[model samples]
Target: MNKKTVKSFRPISWPTKGASAKTGKWRTMRPVIDKEKCIACRICYIYCPEATITPEIEIDYEYCKGCGVCAHECPKKAISMENEVH
Candidate 1:
């Protein structure tokens, strides 16, 4: 297998200004965590393409887009998507 032929896994159309301008920065979105539902499986941390999830059992809101990938892949269904109040 040629290394040059390997397909890349990267995010597309990520706005440089981020979700909005209200935050005055490149903000992604909010990622909500339910401690009751979370089993500490760390799937969010494992599957986050943005590297937004952390091993500290928390989701990095600054990087998370509320994409629901964590919730979709979550075996425990611990994550949820919500609009930020910003």
Candidate 2:
């Protein structure tokens, strides 16, 4: 039996700062929530890829990518994607 020699392994560098990348500016469309239509089911929060949706169903536009996943997945159709103003 032949034994293989192990080489040095690189350590993964994890980001210490929380979501420093502000990608919202790159978004062409933004999600707007209708309070009246919203049932606060937290469906949008669960579907948000950027995790910008709060527990209260408020979207943090700073980190939101405007992917529209939330709006699409919204059961109540409370979320709407609107054109972002530059």
- Location of the lowest summed lDDT over 10 successive residues in candidate 1: 17-26
Pairs of residues at least 3 apart in sequence or in different chains that clash in candidate 2: none
After TM-score superposition, what is the CA distance of residue 18 in candidate 1 from its true location, in Å? 11
Q: Write the per-residue lDDT of candidate 1 for residues 1-86, one digit (tens) a residue.
A: 65555567733333563443333124344567899988888888898877667887776665565666777898887777666665
The lDDT, on a scale of 0 to 1, for candidate 1 is 0.67
Highest lDDT, which number? 2
Where does model 2 exceed 4 Å of error?
A: 1-20
**Clashing pairs in model 1?**
none
lDDT of 2: 0.82
What overall lDDT goes with each candidate model? 0.67, 0.82
RMSD in angstroms between candidate 2 and the native structure over all alpha carbons: 6.9
| Runs with alpha carbons beyond 4 Å of true place in candidate 1 | 1-29
